[model samples]
Target: MATVEQNVSEFRGIIFLVRILFHADIYREALLSRLIILTLFSYFFQNDWSQAVTKFYRTPLLYERSYLNFLYLQNKFSSTKKYKKVTHCLFDLDGTILDSEIIYHKAIQKICERYGKTYTKKLQNQLYGVTDRQLSIGVVSALKLPISVDDFEKQMTELVQKNLTDSPFKEGAERLLWHLSTSKIPIALVTNSTDQAVQMHAKARPKLFSLFHHKVCITDPEVKRGKPEPDMYLLGAARFTPKANPTQCLVFEDSVVGVEAAVRAKMQVVMVPDYRIDKELTLKATIVLKSLLDLDPTLFGIPAFKDGVKRGS
Candidate 1:
């Protein structure tokens, strides 16, 4: 009969062999390791050590599989931690929340046609994130149109107001806004658009627009500068009832200039740029999502969607 010490030594040997098998990076890396495992298995079975033999057969395989699964879960968790929670939400209007960029594009194209200048996609992209004044200045300068900036802006404004009657919400925009409102998240609209223009655009969905706790427009006296400058976002946050720390606020933008403005305001920004925009321009944002559809609110510590609440619906 084996002494108690001998039995303990045998159990320790089995544990050591199991550890090696479980941790092996490559099972074929060494012939000796494989030979040792096989030898131990044979010895345990020959001794009729039922428990030891069963453990030797199952423990290493189970442990190795579980360890690999653990590594996968660890990687997944680390990826999701990239986004942080925010208390207040600010949104850019034209290309971000409302599909009103097309209205702007058509209006600009009409003006370009009058000047015998083509409104190229390049020009459209370059002027995408600027305020009405900036866009007017850019258009006049780029095309050398024989018109005053104020006059050009007036023409574009008229065209936009006429065409803005039924502008649809951008994909995932309505759902996200609804979710935020339902959850009682403080939200605001910070846009380069004029207050009048914003109202015109909202005509189709006044209830949704009404959900915003505040609307800070470029035309507001408090916003001295438009995007690519932080005035608009800073004012938006300040207007919140209790006010929000810039660092605790989150901004969603669809243009490079808007992202820069949010960053300058010292807020985290999620950029959902037009597909045609250059990817390099979006790199400065805290996160770049294809659309709000890709946003996992839970990543920002907000409640995630429940079952049956489809995104972009």
Candidate 2:
């Protein structure tokens, strides 16, 4: 008896002769005939029937392994359109969650006034969502203030702390935070703000800020660079309990620099920018919303609200 293996191997050798049947119909019919013949052979083999069927199914169609790999590569190349799927969310603090841009501007302007200098809008926009060192150094250098970087940092911190302790939340900010929290989605605060700044800002709404799985402050010792550099966002994404990759995270921001950081980190970002921010800068984000209210969670593969953005307070 030519064993079942020998019989199947012989069939495969015979099929290989017509390997040039690249046309779909020809290949399908060829495979169909092989399967039908195998079915009939199974009746006689009995014990070896399972073995014969297994080998036949496993080897045909360019061989199973090659067939599966082809399908996978085809799906990926079938469409150039990008799709976003996120399990973790990273959010920028200041302007994204809290209406602290004006507070920052006021603080810097106060310092400028004391030094007989002006805090221009151009400089204010540049300094937004940047590290304390970057902000202090840039401001002191730009305004030609006599204060040292350390002195500027100290003054700016004090003013921000005093005014920002009661800083209000931006439109739809609390609602979105609460929604994501209740959905059991992991969220992190990724910001250029210092630890002290975060503490001061969280005073009024500690519980809301507490909802964050972790906070990534650029001032943290591990962070070598700030926003527009991707270090902080990458660090934030890595802090998840089951650490997440950049592609698995979606960032929310209100600053152009923040958007650039998320994009560089290989993550998708939603920009809820200040009206004063230039439109061109907002375009860099994956999507731009007039306010967080306009966000559609499903677009980013997040669960949609049960009651549609939740009403009240």
Candidate 3:
């Protein structure tokens, strides 16, 4: 005699075969008769005549239940979509469009070393997203240096400018910008960097930098406060030809402060943070991506790349 597991397996196999036959187009006209015969066979095998007929009847019902579930899932998922439409795009410069944060790190570290203090990673992480003045103050305080914030800022700026002369676009930056430009989407560069820093960056890559419809620097007269404050982003939006509604703008940022600024401006934000950033800090953004390279333009209602078009090609 077969074991209980073997019996169950055999019964399942028979039920599967019956289901297949019942649904076959060629056997459709004889399905009723075959079902009856299969019910009798089940009764003979189980030696429970009444229960066997009920079990066999439930088989078709079970298949019907499964089919209905499959349809429900298909319709449910098909109705869902992730991307939203935006009229304008705003991007932060350092660590977002440009790979300049590491240069800033080196500059600040060199300054800290001059004061016989070390620039710890903990301090760097804390200052990652702060504005220029805020960062200068933070660095001075963190190192317990006796220098004024202005002096520290001046020294760091000199060091950063030297290092930033040939800074490359961050991964995915050039491709996405070119796509948006080709598609005729309005784009702006909004950064907390000073006017001088922005000029230095533009000097390095004038052709690429000239693509923006506007560039809003932290020193712009209209910007009352630096990020984590909405002033800069709001100003950037107003500079557009038709003046975008905050909701109609999408901001790309790589800092928690920038994300917060965009959110406060009532714009949707996509954060592509550095690897050292804490994951929890990114939760406030509308979406977080690993890098600009992983961004799906279609998610923002922008045209997606053609299937065979390689990035940056």
Candidate 4:
């Protein structure tokens, strides 16, 4: 019953409302806007449902939802880990493989105690993943110990010799190593520990140490810098027979320094941190596991262990 001019004026008004509804942030408003869009659509075609059906893709609500969904999918895909074809595994030796962190703590505590100071939890957290020189400096400065870095190193070496550095493997470490070795996947040991420290551990478990393709200690002639710097990790990957791209190596670490080193190398890291470490600190890793036993190699596209058992099997 409306005149042509009147219908055109109403159509323009509908278009203005369509703009507001499409940009609406509230879901309720967006839903209401959808209804309004449908009503206006009906009005525009003079209730020609057949034509609307033919052009549903041109309708704003369906198109808007599709756009929103596309944005959601894109963001979701980006947030997930992209390393599915990991070819080599690199491990941190101290806390990640050996139960040597406790031994290091004990030796440092002895040095601090000699100066009428106690090694605090705060300090231990800082030492995690640090090099021996950094450890000496931190302990000396934090405890206000009356000793030079060299002196501290002297006492630490003496103390470490008395207490065994070749401590037992951490939970599930040996099993995981065996599985990887059996699967014929290359493995490397990357550590910020001194050469003497690594030899002690390797001496204690010659057979176990043999599983590694090679070991990279910070004292290696080729190492330029220690962890929290990517130097050691980069060297470890390069030592592989065929060599590995940084993106193709998967690192397993238990300290903030190790994880950060791996991340700086642009490699994916799985963290198995001590309970004392801040959960927030471990968040930088690709994934955080309570222990090596909790990891599933297949998650990184590595071979499944025998019998198809997932954890501690």
- List TM-scores for all candidates, in order: 0.72, 0.70, 0.72, 0.72
What's model 4's overall lDDT?
0.77
What lDDT is reached at residue 123 by model 3?
A: 92
Q: Which ranges in model 1 have alpha carbons more than 4 Å from their true place? A: 1-81, 307-313
Cα RMSD to the true fold for all candidates: 18.7, 20.8, 17.9, 17.2
- The residue ranges of model 2 lying beyond 4 angstroms of the native Cα positions read 1-82, 309-313
Question: How many angstroms is residue 22 displaced in model 1 relative to the true structure, after the best TM-score fit?
Answer: 27
Q: How far is candidate 2 from the true structure (C-alpha RMSD, Å)?
A: 20.8
lDDT of 2 by residue, 270-296 (tens): 887665554435656776666787677
Model 4 poorest 10 in a row by lDDT: 69-78
What lDDT is obtained when candidate 2 is compared to the true structure? 0.75
**Window of ten residues with lowest summed lDDT in model 3:** 67-76
Q: What is the C-alpha lDDT of each candidate?
A: 0.77, 0.75, 0.77, 0.77
Report residue 209 deviation for candidate 3 (angstroms): 1.0
Model 4 per-residue lDDT tens digits across residues 1-313: 6678756756654664465565555463454455557756775666543344335435566655533332233223334666567999999988888888778889888778878999998888877778888889988988888889999988888887666645778988888999988988899999988788778777778898899999999999999888889999999999999998989899999899889999999899988877656433665788776667767788889977675645521
